[model samples]
Target chain A: MNQILVVDDDRELRTTLVEVLEQEGLQAVMARSADDALERLQQETFDLILLDLVMPGTDGMTAIPLIRRQAPRTRIIVMTAYASVQNAVQSLQQGADDYIVKPFKIDGLMLTVRLNLQKARFCEETEAADLDKIFNGLANGLRRQTLQLLSRQGQMRFMDLVRALEIEDHTKVNFHLKTLREAGFIDQTSDKFYQLTTNGQRAATCLSYICKSLEASAQARPPIVP
Target chain B: MNQILVVDDDRELRTTLVEVLEQEGLQAVMARSADDALERLQQETFDLILLDLVMPGTDGMTAIPLIRRQAPRTRIIVMTAYASVQNAVQSLQQGADDYIVKPFKIDGLMLTVRLNLQKARFCEETEAADLDKIFNGLANGLRRQTLQLLSRQGQMRFMDLVRALEIEDHTKVNFHLKTLREAGFIDQTSDKFYQLTTNGQRAATCLSYICKSLEASAQARPPIVP
Candidate 1:
C-alpha cells in the first residue's frame, strides 16, 4: 500500500486532507507541524510527505533536507498558499519533488501522489531488471572461471580454452561461453575467438582482484596447531 | 591511431616494446620512469599505459592512482616479473585494469592491449548512443515546455497541453508529444492522457530546477545602463 504523511499546522484542514487521502485508498498519516512530522518520520517510513510550508516551528522548507537525509528515497510535495508559491518553488530547489498550492482539489492532490509513486516504481523496476542480468551472469562458478581465463589470456579460441581449462567436455565450456556472451560480459570476434567485453572485463578484473586479496589474507594467517 | 605509454626503467626492453607497439600501428611513447610517465601524461593523453612494477623511483603501483587521476579513462596494465605476479595482482585492487607478467610474449601483450582498447570503444559507443537519444529529446524549446507543463499539472490530455501551450497549430504539439513518447520521457495512459514516465519526470524536475536557478541568477545580475 502507498503510505503518505500529511503535515500541516491547521488542524481542521490537516484532518480533512488525511480523511480524503484515506478515502482515496491510501494509508495517510498526519502530523501537526514539521517537528511532529520529523518525529513521526523516525517512527515510520513514508512513500510521500505532503508538507505545509509555513508552520509555527521548524517550517517545511527547513525540514525538507532533514527529511530527505533521514529517508533518501522518500518523495516530498510541499503545500503552499497562493501567495507562498514562490517560496514553495524555492523548496523544490532544496529537494522537494513537487508542490501543490493550498485550496488544491482533492482530485488534483491525489493525481500528483499517484503519478510520483508510479514514476518511482517504474525507475526501480527498470534498474532492478538490468542488475538482475549482470548478477545472474556472475553467480555461476564456471562462468566466473571462464571470465577469469579470458581476462588472463585476453582472447582464446574455443579449442584453446577447452584445453586450457582441462575440461574434457567441450559442450559444458560452450554453454558457459554462450551464457557469458549473452550477459554482455564477453563477445565473439569475427575470427571465432572469445574475449571479454568492457563490462565483462571490469567484472573479471574485480573478481580476480578480490581473489588475490583473499588468497593473500589466507596465506598471511597462522596455521592451526596440530 | 591508438596512443600507448610504455613506462619502464629498462632502456632496452622499453625501446623494444615501443618499437613493437608502433609497428602494430599504435602510437607508443616511452617513459623511462614513473616521474617521466607522469610528465608525459600531463602533456598528452593516452588510451592505455604499460607500466613496469619495479623502477628506480616512483614504481608502477604508486603511479596507478596518479595516472588514473590524470586521465580517468586511460586503461592501465601493470608489468611485473614472475616472482612479483602476486604483488602485481594486488595492484589490480589499487586501480590497475589488468596485469601482465614479465618474459611475456610480445604477441600476448599486444593482444591484451587490443582487447582493452576495443572494450573501451564499445562502452563509449554504447553510452554515446543512449545519451544521443536523451539529448535529442531535450533539444527543443517546445518539448521542454511540454515537459514543464506535465511536471506542474501531473498529467494532461493532448488538447489540454495544446490549450495550455497556447499553440494554434495542434499538429506541432502532436509532433512534439510523439517525440517525447518515443524518447521514453513520457507515456500515454489507457484513457489517452499524457504523463511523464519515470525518466521523463526526473528530466522534467531537473529542467525545472535548472530553469529556476537560471531565472534567479538573471534577476540577481546588475543591469548595465547605456
Candidate 2:
C-alpha cells in the first residue's frame, strides 16, 4: 500500500480526509502543521504528501523545499482555499507536484491524488533505467567521440568512423561499434552507414554540455601557488 | 553578459564578491538577506545566484527553492563557513547547484561561477531542441502506436508492421514509418527489418508512463451526476 501524509491544521478536516483515505485502502498519516510534517518526513518515507497552504506556522510554500529535501522521491500536493487558486498554481511552480482547492469533493481529491501517485510511480520506474542506459552508453571516450561524430555528420560508413576516430585497429573500432549498437545509441542504415539512434542524439547533446562544463572549469583553473 | 545575484548578510563580503564578479565581466547584484534576495529575484532575472547559507532571517538554505521558483534556470552556489561544510551539502540537497567555502580564494570562486554558468547555458540550448523533437515525434496517434509496436516486437518488416498495427492500408503505414524514421525513432536493417532506435525506446518508455497516468485518471474519475 502507498503511504500518504496529510498536513492540515483543521482537526475535523484531517479526520475526515484520513477516514476517506483509509477506506480507499491507502495508508494515511496526519500532521497539524508544516513543522509537524517536516518532522514526520525526516522519520518516515511517504509516497505522497497533501499539504495545506495556509498552515499557522511555516506555511506550505516555505515548507515545500524543506519537505522535498527530506523526501526527494515523494510527491507533494498543495491544498488551498478556493479563493487562493493562484496560490495553488504558485505551489506547483515552487515544486509541489499538484494542487487541490479547499471545499474539494472527496472524489475530486482522490482522482488528483491517484493521478499524481501514478505519475510518481512511473517516474521512479523509468528514470533509473533510462539514466543507466545513457550513462553506460557514454562511459567510454571512444563511444562519446562516436556519438559526437555521428551527431555532427548525421551518418558515416564503418571505415569512415574508424578514420575519424583515428583508431589503428579495425577490430577495436568494430568492438566499440558493436557496443554502441547493443547499447541502442547507434544503428546501421540499410546501406551500411552508421548513425546515432534518437537516444544517441540526445546523449550527444548531453555530452556537449558535459564537455562545455569541463572546458569552462579547465579554463578557469588558477595558477598554483609556488 | 551573464547576470548574477550575491546574497549575503555581511556588507563587506557582498561588495567584495560583486566587485570580483564584475571584474570577470559578469553583472552582479547584491542582497542583504534571503528576504532581500527573494525581492530581487522577483524583480530581475539572474543567470546565477551566490547564496550565503547562514543569515539572520530566512537563511540561504530556505532561500534556494524560492530563488529557484522565481528563476528556474538560474544556477545557485551556496557560500558557507569552513565549520558548516555539512550545511553546504544540505544546501545542495535543497536545490543549490554548487557550494564554496567562505574565507575563500577569488580564483576558486570565479572557477565555480564560470563552470555553473556554462552548465546553465548548455541546458538552455539543448533542452528546447530535444524537447521539440520528442514532442513532435509523439504528437500523432499512429506514430505513438508504431513506437509501442516496435518496442514490444523488437523489429518488424514493412508488411509485418502493417499487419501488427491492424491497418489495411500499406500506404498509411509507410507514411507513419517515414515520419518515425525521420524523427530518429526507428531504423531500417540491412535485412529489411524495422526497429526502434535507442531514443525510440526511451520515447516508448515515456509513452508508457503517459498512458498509465491517463489510465489511472480515467479510472479514478467520479461518475457523472445527472
Model number with the top TM-score: 2
- Candidate 1: list runs displaced more than 4 Å: A1-226, B82-89, B127-129, B132-226
TM of each candidate vs. truth: 0.33, 0.43
For A1-226, candidate 2 gives per-residue lDDT tens digits of: 7899999999999989999999888889899999999877656789899999888989989998667545655788888774332354346435566666678899999987887777666555554455456656665667767876777566899999899999999899899889989988899999999988866765665543333222222333443221
Clashes of each: 0, 1
lDDT of 1 by residue, A104-196 (tens): 888888877876665444434433343345446655666766776776566889999999888999999999888888888899899999998
Least lDDT summed over 10 consecutive residues: which range in candidate 1 chain A? Answer: A210-219
lDDT score of residue A89 within candidate 1: 35
Q: B1-226, model 2: which lDDT tens digit per residue? A: 7889999999999999999988877889899999998887666778889998889999778888667545555788888884342354345435566767777899989887887777676556644455445556666667867887777566889998898789999999999889889989899899999999866765665553333222222333443211
Query: Fraction of the real A/B interface contacts present in each candidate?
Result: 0.00, 0.00
DockQ of each: 0.02, 0.02
**What is the per-residue lDDT of model 1 for residues B172-208, given as tens digits with 9 covering 90 to 100?**
9999999999989999899999999866765554342
Q: State the weakest 10-residue window (summed lDDT) of model 2 chain A.
A: A210-219
